[model samples]
Target chain A: MNERVGTTVLSLTGISKVYGEGPTRVDALRPTAFEARAGEVVAIVGPSGSGKSTLLTIIGLINPPTAGSLLINGEPVITDGVAVANLTTMRRRELGYVFQRSNLIPFLNAEENVRLALEIDGVPAHQSRTRARELLESLGLGKRLAALPGKLSGGEQQRVAIARAMIHQPSVVLADEPTAALDSGRGRQVMELFRDSAHAHGAAVLVVTHDHRTLDLVDRVLEMEDGVLSEKQPA
Target chain B: MMDLAVRDIRNDLSRFLLTAAGLGMLMSVVLAMTGIYNGMVVDATVLPDTYGGDLWVVQKGTQGPFAESSRVPALLADRIRAVPGVERTRSYMTLNVQHELGDGETLRFMLAGLSWPDDLGNSLPLAQGRALRQPHYELVADRALGLPVGTSLRLGRDDYTIVGITSGMVSSSGDPLVFASVSDALRIQNDLASEALRLERESRVSRVRRSEYGRDPANLARAGSAAPLPVTSPPPVTAILVDVAAGGDVEAVKASLLGWPDISVYTIDEQRELLVRGVIDRARRQIGLFRALLVLISAIVMGLIVYTMTLDKMLSLSLLKLLGAKQRVILRLILEESLLLGISAYLVALLIGELAFDLFPRRVLVQDLDRLALLGVILGLSVAAGMVGLRKALAANPNEVLAS
Candidate 1:
């Protein structure tokens, strides 16, 4: 195990979300407490409307929790339900996300799509290009760097998305069903990439998925039910 | 950073260029409207500019010869010459006439008369041939009339040869000007049909018999003669153009002419202003309103186009925002694309105008300043259109990328 595997990089305490008011009020999350340490690939699995995505959104910093203290890299991001750190800056510098689909800009080539993340962080063009090429090559996409998203296969596109997510070496990488569109064999490959990203780069990888075939590749599995979250033991 | 706007355009170059071409055609029409108004002003003032006179003396209380009718005594030129600062004077006459072209076509023109032996239209810009050399049968025709030099035109009872051709010499109303001697113009104006003359003679005979000399056969015979009676006084002229001597004050000469209660005097600049403001003011306003409306339409259409384009990129933009792309970065992308579209459309408009403006029936004077001003307007329009797209882009929900 990597030495950084024991360090807690993301922490969420008593985080909950509710919609509307009065009789229309409904709980989306039930005071969830979770920690994702560096060099750990954690999976959150649940059926539809089970609050898994709600928890993911909160961890991704895309939605503010109704009540919570959230921290990243030992710094307070959201304290007692009030955001103390700039959310946009933290999202840019410390957080990365991969969606179900590749979500690459269609007009840009594969390398350019990956380079866009670094470019958004104000990286120099030449340096970003070099890093983007290296990342894509490491993801087995060196031959397809000049291909647009439309020309790349589903598995190849997902790999490019993974490269894009890891380009800035973010502390926490949130993925929402990163392998849902791939076949079982290709799905396992992508899950393995998440494992590699966590172990080699010391990133706290959290994937929200329904795919079970790749669950064995993850370090831990957390299951959600009825807006409640709990750890599930291996069979 | 990579130019996101340019990359998008290159990815869909054919569609982008087609859109620009459509916008270019609309912009060309807007430019043409401006040019037509400019052409109208130039046409209204061309005569005054070419006449190069210091003052114009017309009938009192009237804006003569171009904007309104003002007929003064033809000999008024002589009286105007007596002013202290008046260096020279020429009798100016104008009449609108229509002649059959022998092909079911009627040629309508403005007949402008120049004083022969004194003013043979030497001041006119002759594009071909020479000015009127004879007092009775020579003419100077504007090129717009489509009459070549040496073409003889029959007016009234005489045939006049086109001796000179002037280009761009049209009246305030856009009618081509045909120049002739004062004598020939007056004869054409006064020429009467034979039957009308016969009736007038008989009426004169009856009036003479009814008078105290009713029984006098000599007076009856004189009235009944077959020969046409001679006019007792000369025909009236439209106005008198005056030139002031060097180191002379034109206002003083104009004031002296204004002293005559029967005539109105105006400086050369005032004459041009009368033609522009009095003669073509309504037309200018109409064209101006049309130009303004076209600019507004261009803005609206461009805005809608930009909005639609932004909608097309909604997903991609959402993904970028979700990836922590700055708001300003996305704004720059939209603004740059809008500017690029506007600039490309403007270039296309200029090309269309250059190739096609002359084909218009009326003169289209596309001035450089007008082009520069329009470019500024297009830039403004581009920015405005970009704002429409930027609003949509900024409101894009980055969470939608996750949903998708």
Candidate 2:
């Protein structure tokens, strides 16, 4: 395998993003460069209104960079730092995301919600349901399979979210303040789950968090300030 | 994934149940409309069938007995009886009148004058007691009137005893029917004031007095000088009731009666058509409108629900998008959710409709065809609602997941 492909599941070379035309324009991210590799856990930590969310959005392909190229597994998907159309398909097959509040479907139980990710992919009912149970059990939620979101605790819900992200076995998982609703202990436990999921399952996991107590859980950490990515410590 | 619609439903039973309950009420109304229509059709035609006539003989060119007034001499039964196809014939005097029960509750009733004797020896299927056999005083009433047998009622200035009560024999207007002997029927067929009868008697006396004064009452005035009056018998009944033979062709018999009088004839089938086409059309149209309105409201509800659910799961949608879940998949999930809700509601509505019908006096039919049609409508509506959610999901940006 090529070094670029193995070392980086996602590599953004000098990406910059700006909103609007002239007077109302804003630069949410300015010439940021970063890479996330397979089997590695990374956190993007920043305070509120520090362009952290904007940076995360750009990396997640929700918004395009104004400049720079983005490559996935050594394949260039963006050129001149501008996204081409048809990005929706590219993101779905390659990426997974976790949100701050679990954001689980209230109508669906833990297993069902996780199963929805597979079902949305056109997986057969039996297989998807089976896989959902497997994932939930693996996440230490074997007993909460039939329980609805209301019945599950904050930590359990996030664990379900993690299971859903990995259910499709995507190469990359993105988390946006995944433990914001959890207490310190549960938050730390959820962070460890992501770390273990990435390394043991060969996934590239990028988490955006405000929880610094579990910073050591990640293999590497990326800090952004006014839209620039800086490496703080080696893996 | 799209199949998880059922799974989701199972997971959140309470939410599903509440939605179904609301939906069930709507369905019940729909079913009731169908039942009411059936009742209307049956009620309007039931009277024509009871008369046991192939055709009605009336004054020409008018729909009589129920819709208009028609009168012919009571003697016409003789001529009608001689018709070739009229194997057996009977005369009757029918009138619609209001009677105040002993309890002071007024109800409309049909006064029937029966002429011919039957196998029961001029009797009827009575709830209690016997048939009206006496002239001017005996009466037979329908059991629905809640009147007791052997009771007496005042008809105009005359009092008559209720000798019997028949079950299920009602007029077109839901009035209870009463049977009186032909003599009494003809007597009160046209009621008049006591003063009017006395005045006519005094005129006769005046004629006798004038004759004694040596001037003939008829010769006392020129043709234009005096208001001329003629002595008359009571006006004949409006129409006669005849029972056609079981094998008799009603249309054929109806054609024969068309030649008899100043009235028009109507068969039971013809009566049904008139009711549906003339009187009941407007109500049917109203029901159609209500059905459309209900469908529109239900569709809007589904759209709003799916959209709200989508908004709640925006982050998850973006995540799915990032993981290469197709737009179609997301769209399917939204649609599936809607369809699930619709089906659940549809079933609930039918159940409620049936239960309501059991308790209510009015008719309500929850037909299978209507239920199937509702299912189709709900499925289509849900699919539309899902599209709204799909649009929202597709609007989510995966880049948000990567943000710091």
Candidate 3:
């Protein structure tokens, strides 16, 4: 894990988001510079409506930043506020996301939920199934593979979500309050999984969370107030 | 690749199957309407098709025997037979009568004169018994009338025994057809109750007393008696069916008969056209309108169902989009689900139609072409319905997943 610690996996320079024009204009996210290296977990904490979700959305490539240069694995995906490459392909091959709710597709079982990510990337069914089973087993969900999201508990569901995110071996994994629905113990377990995913798998991890009980599990903490972001060392 | 559509359907199979079943019931109605319309066409043209005559002669300026009222002299058959190129001619008469079934239940049917001894209804499609042998009391009844062979039915003061059972034979109005000899049909047409005979005799006597014949006591006395009045000539036949000699010019024969000035001639095909296009045109329109409305209703229902199912899966779709799924993936999911639902419903409709179509009062002829055409329509409708859900799916914001 330490061998790949210094490798830069994600970089954003002067990233900002503005919603409207004239008086109706609102700054959802202010210009911010940030980076996460392999084998590291970075946590973003802020009050309600403090642009944490906005920042996460931009980093996830779900929404375009108004002015920014963004790079993943040393390749420029966005430069000078314009998408230089296909954002969807970049997201599919380079990024993974875990929402506040596990957001597991209700119809698909735990194993299928993880397999779908690989399928979207055009992986063959046998390889995808093998990879999904291995990943779910590593996440301690082997027995619950055929169980649907509705049939699983909160922690089990989040573990399945983590397996789904890690199945594609994306360079960066972003979580927006992934443990908001889980209890304290389950939330801590989920944070430890995120840490292991970053440290062991060499993926750059960023999480937006209001819960501070799991703060020590992260390597760095970034605080956001209104539309501005500021970094602080993890306690 | 994983079949996301199939996975979703299996997740909620009961509801999906139930929805398909409901839609199938509606589609079955549409199929039934199409079948009824086809049956009507068959019923209207069956006689002309089965008669296999090359030409028909009817009263001038009339469509006759099936579509309009026509009365040509019974002797017109002899004249038509003498025309050039005419090989054979037979007198044809048809009338609708209500026959009592001995239990106060009346069966209304169209009684057609077969010109027996000349035309014994041998050309009719007999499903069970023999053709008419005796001209007077023998009848060939359509199976739709539910009269078995050898069953006696009372019609116009005479009991006629069912000799042969014809299948799928009906009038333009969908009433069953019963064939009897021309003489028996004529007698049935002319039969009257005893009170009506007395009234006729009194009227004839009064007419005789007022004329110059009143001075003759013998004529007056004979007119006042209960004895039946002497017949002047045989009853007029409805029309004459003519068969042209093989290798003969039917058009020339028709032209020769057209010169009579009192009768009109038509080729068999023309007579069929008159019956289909003129006799049952209104019914066709009515049934066609119903079928169109049913199809429209089915489309609307299918659209609503697909839209609602999409609505239920909006979050899942947004999640898939956020997970970097291409737009076409989500579109395929919705479209595939809609298509499966439609195909399943169509199969169910076929099963229902097979089970219930024969129970309808009118014959239901479900032709293969009609079935294939309807399947094409259903496929088209399913795709069109899928569009309703696709619009909503494509518009779903992936950012919603972040908020969730």
Two-chain DockQ for model 2: 0.46
lDDT of 2 at A196: 75
Tens-place lDDT digits, model 3, residues B232-258: 679899889998999999888888888
Give fnat of each prediction, in order: 0.60, 0.74, 0.81
Q: What is the lDDT of residue B163 in candidate 1?
A: 92
Estimate TM-scores for all models.
Answer: 0.94, 0.79, 0.95
Error of 2 at A115 (Å): 2.3
- lDDT of residue B286 for candidate 3: 94
RMSD of each: 2.5, 5.6, 2.5
What is the TM-score (0 to 1) of candidate 1? 0.94
> Model 1, stretches more than 4 Å misplaced?
A1-6, B200-229
lDDT of 1 by residue, B352-404 (tens): 99999999878889999999988999999999999999999998888888888
- lDDT accuracy of residue A128 in candidate 3: 95
Residue B67 lDDT (model 2): 59
Please identify which of the two predictions, 1 or 3, would achieve the higher TM-score against the true structure: 3
lDDT of 1 by residue, A198-222 (tens): 7777789999999999999999999
- lDDT values of the candidates? 0.89, 0.71, 0.89
- The CA lDDT at A74 in model 1 is 91
lDDT for A115 (candidate 1):
92
